[model samples]
Target: MARSRWLPDQHGAWAMLTVPFLAGTFLAPHPGPAHAVLLAAWSAGYVALFHGQQWLRLRLRRASRRPAAARCHVRPGLVFAAVFLVLGIPLAVRHPWLLLAAAACGPFVAVNTLYARVNRERALPNGLAAVVPACGMLPVAGRLGGAGLPWAPAAACLLYFWGTVPYVKTMIRERRSAGYRRASAAYHAVAIVAATLLSPWLALPFAGYLARAVALPGRGVKVPVVGAVEIAGSAALLLTLLLVF
Candidate 1:
């Protein structure tokens, strides 16, 4: 009944979860009712995955943490999984081919679960694993809307979301590591170039992304500020993608 146990704890995941879907849905040429169903399915799947990962982490990592904590997730996990299947099956019946995206994301989901079970869910690998599938959703949703994979926009989406992983690491997990700082900066630089090549229009927002990646890491800015900046960056990317493509 408590809210904490009912909701996902990854505050920033809210944006990561939706932007790609919106990007893909909006970019799709033949957007329809199925896309809405897909969104609901996708959301249920994400919440299910989140709780499932947490349950595995608590259940397998140690006995000292208490089984009750793990069990609390079981109900929510099952409920969401059922919801995902309910919303997903009809779309699969209609499209049949969209399952490919779900299948493709499976390995990454496994990686995330593995890291969670090992209590390393916050590690860079786990973060990247999460980013890949989340970004991959762009193409899936685009194709769902009859966009035919929308490669250019999808690549742009991947570029933006991928950089966030290492950038966030530089802010939180690897804040003191100069190596991470360099890596994050380098990634943003590459993202900017890639976005530019994809479309000259995308370069500006990515440049803004690069500036924040470079300037804010060691500045002791609050987490909320970091989150706000990321939110803005995501919004800019989504808007720019919509406008350009």
Candidate 2:
């Protein structure tokens, strides 16, 4: 939690904390203490999950061969998990429905664990696995904030990131392949078109996304520059969603 210039690797973490939690809270007619506590619990749980996963990774690498930092994460990871569990107990007592989110996360954690064991963290199955828990947070946010489950915003969040995975893959993981770049551009283009047809307001940020994906990927833009643009796009999305919905 150094909170230096935002790490590119933590995009999913930030998205999970921001989009659903803020949108759901904003959409609520009257948010109160329970919503606050639940959000805190959820955020802490995500921290725990992140560290715990890191610890697992280090442990696995240690088994294969001794590595520096292998022992460092275990205590911190467990501390976060303990804190998360403690926070959850009372929140669950206050809102029984929180159990449902817990149950949903079980399968997600399972999937993540399976992928991690195979060292397939960047694989499609792993990416989809990451997105599901973020989707689950939307409903939790809605429930805690005294709103009905927010399916529309949740779906919007899902579609936005679902498109993001392949687009990013083309930029970083599969940057060498012209074919993959074309495929990513086309996917973004289709997303923009579909979003426009569905709702022009909704498509505003996706239009920006399509532009960047098409224009910037093959060019030699730096990583931080790409991150800055993505941050702007995310701000555009947050603003658009706030104003329209």
Candidate 3:
């Protein structure tokens, strides 16, 4: 495949990967080269796995229609994935548990890939799986940075994004349903309140989420604006984590 073909089109997933990695690295009490290498290796492996699985699914679907063309696409993607995997091996070797964490996260990726294959990548399962790899970052950074796993912060991040699932549904698939919009708003509002009760500062992002869920939908917020808002919200969440915990 050409270099462009190796790149993924899913910009949202990229943000999801980057934010947590940075959070884990920066929030770690003492970040060092090991943390950097671990994050790099993990990210490389993640991209390889994602693209490889995508190509496999594409090939399978197209095999009956155009087997030869499918093979051509699969071969290059697999080769690219293999090259990336090889690059990560040396780093993964020194920290075997990092590999274990990746293995654990692999099932979630597989689940996501399967959903994508069936054209259900926006389902509830995808929202849940989106957080798995990110959660794994907590332990990796913690172990390397001498922070010993920042569970509280990790939980906050998890719940914050998890809330996005329902809220986003209201903006897209469930957009016409007042009930779902209400439900999404209610969930976010509750989350904000709960997070605030737990830690006043931690609720800031959720509050922003709540505000958007209530104010944006039915107000003609397009998909691109929605994405921009999400990215901005994620940044706010990352900043909150960096300062609070």
Per lDDT, the best of the predicted structures is: 1
Q: Which ten residues in a row have the lowest lDDT in candidate 2?
A: 1-10
Name the regions of candidate 2 deviating beyond 4 angstroms.
1-9, 193-198
Query: Residue 220, candidate 1: how far off, in angstroms?
Result: 1.2
Colliding pairs, model 2: none
lDDT of 3 by residue, 107-140 (tens): 8887888886775767887878877777667656
C-alpha root-mean-square deviation, each candidate: 1.3, 2.7, 2.5
Write the candidate numbers in order of decreasing TM-score: 1, 2, 3
Two-way lDDT contest, 1 vs 2, winner? 1
Q: Which is superior by TM-score, 1 or 3?
A: 1
Give the runs in model 1 whose Cα sits over 4 Å from its true position. Answer: none
For model 3, name the residue pairs that clash. Answer: none
User: Which ranges in model 3 have alpha carbons more than 4 Å from their true place?
Assistant: 1-4, 66-76
Error of 3 at 235 (Å): 0.8
The digit string of per-residue lDDT tens for model 2 on 1-245 reads: 44431122576457656776777777777777777777777776777676666657767766567564555555556776787788889988877878877897899888887776666778877887788787668667777777888776777676677777776777777777788789778878887776665567888788778888888777777767766776777677767766776
